[model samples]
Target chain A: MVHAEASTFAEGLSKKQVYEQVLGQAQALFDGQRNWVCNLANASSLLYHAYHSLPSPSNAVNWAGFYVLDPKNPKQLILGPFHGQVACQTIAIGRGVCGTAVEKKTTQLVEDVERFPGHIACDGASKSEVVVPIFQDGRVVAIIDVDCAELSGFTVEDQVALEHVAELIAKSCDF
Target chain B: MVHAEASTFAEGLSKKQVYEQVLGQAQALFDGQRNWVCNLANASSLLYHAYHSLPSPSNAVNWAGFYVLDPKNPKQLILGPFHGQVACQTIAIGRGVCGTAVEKKTTQLVEDVERFPGHIACDGASKSEVVVPIFQDGRVVAIIDVDCAELSGFTVEDQVALEHVAELIAKSCDF
Candidate 1:
């Protein structure tokens, strides 16, 4: 059973503190569940609500979700679990921020999505975005994509925190 | 490209009208995407946000999501894409409302979840629930589950509309 308490962040915590709480809660949630479908579904919910519980710009997050590498198509990503508005269904390996993260095998943190070339506008309200590739056995399995309605919504600290999350997901789930 | 406009329901539209809009937008969203992962992900988002765009009790919905039949374990339903709080990872067929939908091959509409025997509490705030089975061939492929914060949150009208949505999903995507 997933407790509502798990998704509710305590008030007055710093962004880093909130993320630390999320990581701990996520670890506990994934203790015996290795299915990517279940894990990603819960992970997106946890992150989405956690951010909303925060103050200001963090609360401006418009989308937080996953796009997994299509098993039959090695070069394409299909939408996975998410907590947001309707989104793009498929994205190629080198098209948008999500694709660029996979192609580069590194996280792409764009302070302003409009400034980024070839940015796929899934949600017009999204002003900034971050994509973190999840790898397994030296191959990318999925990418975590988060978008916010405010410019420069994410900083280096967010990238570092989310990258840790990506690493945890890569190890905790079975693609 | 998925426009944010596809998710925002117009004000003062009746519940039936809202669902009609959702079904139309969902069809447009799934026009080219046949992958269940992508379709279900977007479908849940469309339902969740559409419900919230309504007024008062109708907006009390807390969860809208899918649970797919486990490929490896045919007797179980694994969590799929959703727009809600963290949820149960797996439910054996015939257990919860979702499982019962699969077991009985019919929709389960509970006025109050607390009164349902063997009800699964994924989100504590959820008071009423509805689960509609999505079928392909002669077997259940997935189930659409929605929860609301008020008792008797759904009516016969809701079940009828959602069943239509379920049938549309059954024909539009590949599991």
Candidate 2:
């Protein structure tokens, strides 16, 4: 019987502590589950709620989700599981932040989305964004995309933490 | 360029009017997209946020998502796009509300989840649930599952409206 617990960070926990807790919970949740759809669906939910459980900027996270390589069209990414307002359905490779992550095969952590050239605005309220590539067998299989409502909303620590999450998803799920 | 507008219902709109508005928006969103993942992802977001935009019992909706028939395992429903806390990864056919909808090829409108035989408590806070089957070629392909925090939170009108939504999805997306 799979059950989902409410993702509430303990009181007075530091940001790093909160991330560590989220990472631990994610590992436990992914145990014995290799389905990409299921894993990504829960992953978005976990990240979205975890951010909201915090104060200020972190709580301003407007989106958390995944975009996977389209099976029919490898040059594009189709939206996967996500928690947010509705979003762009398909993004061609190298087109936007998500596309650039696929093109660069590395994490793109933009402090301000408006400053990024060719940034696709799916939600007008999103001010900053991060996209982490999830690799499988040396090829980018999917990307984790998070958007915040404030400028410079994510830190270097956030990039590092989410990279770890990317690696975890890469290893744990069969994309 | 695909854009996601904020799903804010106008003030004083009746529940039926809300569904009608949602259906119209969904049709417009699905106009050119055939990918099930993208459509379902947006569908869940639309339903979840639309409900939250309202007051009281409708606002109490905690989960709105899809359970797709697992291609790898034809007898089980794997988690798909969703907006909520983390959830169960899979449910066997006929085992739970979602699964039963698949097995029966009909909608399951449970006023109280606690009393449903073999109820799968993915989220303990869920008091009521409605599962509507999405059919393709006269066979069930996926299901729309919505969970509410209050007993009898869904009405017959909701069921009818969602059935129309299901038909729209069936015709619009490629499963």
Candidate 3:
């Protein structure tokens, strides 16, 4: 991290640097703020601003937001706070990219959404995608979904870092 | 156009058809709802859903949202309701793609964000972008910013149609 301004990151930060900055921001945003909606809103905002500033391919993240499992329907996920265009309102547990993350209880880094069978096209411009499940009390509560325009846009590092963010949210927020 | 289910459009609707459908939905969503935040929120959602369900290539829209002129700071554009990841909250006029649109008070369609000088990267995945200014009494009030992952994602028809939507919004909403 060639230190630039503290508010705006120096251009050309490595992906690792960007993720580190994002994780730190996430911690600061969620600190002592157990309000789920506010935390998710700012977290998504922090991730967007962080990834938006990175260079080329690594910075190609188009969408980042959360989808919480509907308390009314254990088998369904509903739209929560997000930073992108409007998205699908409900997704079944076993359906689409977000649902699959919940069904599998793991991070999914999809290189091509068109190739993902049953993939929900919330933003057709989204070519590749990733979804990380957030768990609390040993059950899935919400998932973070990020989409990109290029195929194979997300790497394993992104999965790991975002999963770490998810873990943070799982521990920090009140659901 | 081939007739498909009413809920789902036929695969190859001309640009005209897509815009018409989008404009209709925009009208329905904004009807009698004058609140700016709610109106912007639903408008972005309507556009995202309309475009996301389209066929490939045309469906490649990545970001759809608004940047309203700040009431306190006349020279700034503040992030408004949107459907994608978090975004840069404040943009100075003439600084970035969104700001440039406001500065010029005209529609801007860029094939590549990387090439656009002083372009602020809100989402690294956005390769192509279009911004349309919303005018009230011959002054810019807000602008609609749409981004795509693919180069040249938007078309002239999108400009015309989205401009129409902006007109409707300017007329319908109390800003």
Interface RMSD of each candidate, angstroms, one decimal? 1.2, 1.7, 9.0
Q: What is the DockQ ranking, best to worst?
A: 1, 2, 3
Order of models, best lDDT first: 1, 2, 3
What candidate 2 keeps of the native contacts, as a fraction, is 0.87
lDDT of 1 by residue, A41-125 (tens): 9999999998998887899999999999987788899899999888888899999899999999999999999999999987889
| Interface RMSD against the true structure, candidate 2 | 1.7
- Candidate 1 reaches a DockQ of 0.79
Segments in model 2 whose C-alpha atoms lie over 4 Å from true places? none
Q: Write the per-residue lDDT of candidate 2 for residues B1-175, one digit (tens) a residue.
A: 5566746567678888889888988888888889888888989998998888777788999999999999889999999999987888889999989999999999999999999999999889999999999999999999999999999989898899999999999999987
DockQ of each: 0.79, 0.75, 0.08
| lDDT by residue (tens digit), candidate 3, A44-76 | 666766777877665677677788887657888
Give candidate 1's TM-score: 0.97
Error of 3 at B142 (Å): 21
lDDT for each residue of candidate 2 in A1-175, tens digit (9 for 90 to 100): 5566745566667778888877887887789889888888888988998888778788899999999999989999999999998888889999989999999998998999998989899888999999999999999999999999998888898899999999999999997
How many clashes in each candidate?
A: 0, 0, 10
